[model samples]
Target: MTVQYKFPDNFWWGSAASATQMEGAAHEGGKGENIWDHWYKREPNRFFDGVGPETTSDFYYRYKEDIQRMKEIGHNSFRFSISWARLIPGGEGEVNQEAVNFYNDVINELLKYDIEPFVNLYHFDMPKEQQDKGGFENRDVVALFAEYAKQCFDLFGDRVKMWFTFNEPIVPVEGGYLYDFHYPNIVDAQKAFQVAYHTMLASALAISHFRKLDIKGQIGIILNLTPSYPRSQHPADLKAAHRADLFFNRSFLDPAVLGEFPTELIELLKEYEHLPAYKEEDLTVIKENTVDILGVNYYQPRRVKAKDHVPNPDSPFMPDWFFDNYEMPGRKMNPYRGWEIYEKGIYDIMINLKNNYGNIPSFISENGMGVQDEHRFLKDGRIEDDYRINFIKGHLTWLHKAIEEGCHTKGYHLWTFMDNWSWMNAYKNRYGFYSVNLETQERTAKKSAYWFKEVAENNGF
Candidate 1:
């Protein structure tokens, strides 16, 4: 077999998973209710197939076998997020020893197989009690989050060197406050911006504590960076793209990596009287505690065009006020979930970091194709998911080009290792190298899994 795109030595290769998404002990193991757990219980009809996060993949009881499978597939690194609700139930109180024991076992097990564990502090799983206290909207809750982060650092920092403070911090804001997809489902721009600000502040504070504690490992945050492309070269279209980028990508990227908010974003917020409440001294904390590394999760690109209609001043303030989504004619898309499949988006992101964001060391924290009704593709007890293999290869080719062009790209991790229950959608879109049987919990390798095994073992394909 010809290896046309060889990767650098020791390039990380595996997949990423979250505690709420995969680990299924939502009620047991002293794991209190996260927002997801509470939301699903309250509004069961909101979730697909009326399913909840009670038992998704059952990693709580089966992580040992899963770690073994990761080793079998030649995984050098794996990323999993810690459940804040589980670790410190109610978000701030006595630490749950059972939860601590479980995570310690999982980390130690991965190390036993020579698999490096990349642990994330939070992944949108705010404890229900904290949400009652206003979640990230309140600055006092922000301090509690840092304390929770410090507990994690002290508990597992020795073995888990690669620590991520938050995985896609902007997601909770967009989902919970701006949109109605997540818990505490409100639709207030003011609250959304406040949540976003507090989340970043919490991340910086955690980084400060990590440095002050002299943790002998790197700390970073995973941001889902969607490169906003203009529909045309027209000035209006370019402006729309720029605004979308400012709102989505740079909002979190600049503050996490550069330690400051974008001036333009601040001006826009001020114009609308929607600036989030913040103290003057918090900006200095953000400036001094930038991340040591970055995790870039690229799933697709955002194409925007100038709003076709004149704005109505009476309308509620929203990011959409500046631009409208442009569905590029003839763009490739994954029909399963109607998500655009733009491989070059990964390269564009890496080069942007190279040119604009100091080429900070980064990796593809999560990228993979999810297919619905994956069982239909099963042949002889294995899914012949050539589409997923092609999806990964296409993105890797672009990523390879970015590395050659001097981008500080490091590694790639798929969205998941196995078919885990997704949020709200439950298990509708399967994005995994291994197709898991929900009934028997049997893990069957899809075609892409074997293809990826060779790639990881050979350093490329």
Candidate 2:
């Protein structure tokens, strides 16, 4: 017998994209260059296929048509981020009316189609000017971010009720600060902890600001939660998993929802003398302000084991010091993206929210496969993305199970609505229901797009 899956009432059936990922016109409308534009210009070879985000899906110019397509896909809601540099060229001084007008137009267009708009303030694309001034590392950037959030609320809050402070806050710390993959790549674990702290502080400040605005809809932060698993029953493996969880998941999860940093986090950071700089009252603010909802983007779970190699005395201390990634033999995998396939990660996150944290309303804000060389699958005008169809269905099955078992999952939004410029990977991996033709500016819905429309209409698959 075939199994069936269904969603809750008023399930938001849409996808997510960032300003840097989807909106072209990077230099147009008095928009200052972001870190992405600067990074590509400095090192074009760093991005896959040498494709930058500047010439993305052209959503800046083609939003009306794109939004119309969203309606056809039965999207009751959509989530997209606003570029800070575009809105305020220098990141904190003058307001660029052109950007304000453009975003207002986009939000209005979505509403016209009866699709609710979920607007995110930041998505890893820090303004180059702000980065030069120390970005998230310096405490000053947090103040600027709060100001930017306030400006956004003052302008667009009336139309957009759901506000997100940041998308995948841990990503920048991991990918940018610790790993060499992202810009301003520094491998200092201390700096990574500081950056993570400032980001959470910024989120708390924004939530406090939202309370002042008295917005109608919910405000929250988006976390890419990775459930950590121990490799064995050994005490060392169990301890390693605990440390990994403290570093990756609890760093943001605790403060954003529980309104306080985990005590384990403090002890771990103290062991390394990596405590971030904080004032006397910062803890109070964090303990007081928590999000109204939780936006979880679960891609995969972390399989951790006790470190194989003892710590090299001369080597720089990193998060890997305590644990190593234990690749499970014969585990399901998504070869295209080179990531583990764990559909139950979604349910695990839900259960974590229900059991440990208060069952705050949450949603799968971003989850999808990123296929490299996807054009090879294109036939005629459509890309037959059966793999993507399977990916969504598999994950949705787990999500449905979680919800039926009383997880307060509100909705599921795919990683993207259409193929756009991904950071580092650029356009190499396409995670879209619609195919984007760069040469002719054509948009064609993949088979998954049609399949998703039915799922959205019926609230099931």
Question: Candidate 1, 53: how far from true, in Å?
Answer: 0.3
Residue 270 in candidate 2, Cα distance off native in Å: 0.7
lDDT, candidate 1, residue 373?
A: 97
**Residue 107 in candidate 1, Cα distance off native in Å:** 0.4
The top-ranked prediction according to TM-score is 1
* Model 1 C-alpha lDDT per residue in residues 360-385, reported as the tens digit of each score: 99999999988999999989989999
Candidate 1 segments whose C-alpha is farther than 4 A from its true place: none
Deviation (Å) of 169 in candidate 2: 0.7
lDDT of 2: 0.90
* The candidate that achieves the highest lDDT relative to the unseen native structure: 1
TM-score of each: 0.99, 0.98
lDDT of 2 by residue, 150-205 (tens): 99999999989899999999988888789878887788878888899999999999
Instruction: Give residue 275's error in model 1 in angstroms.
Output: 0.7
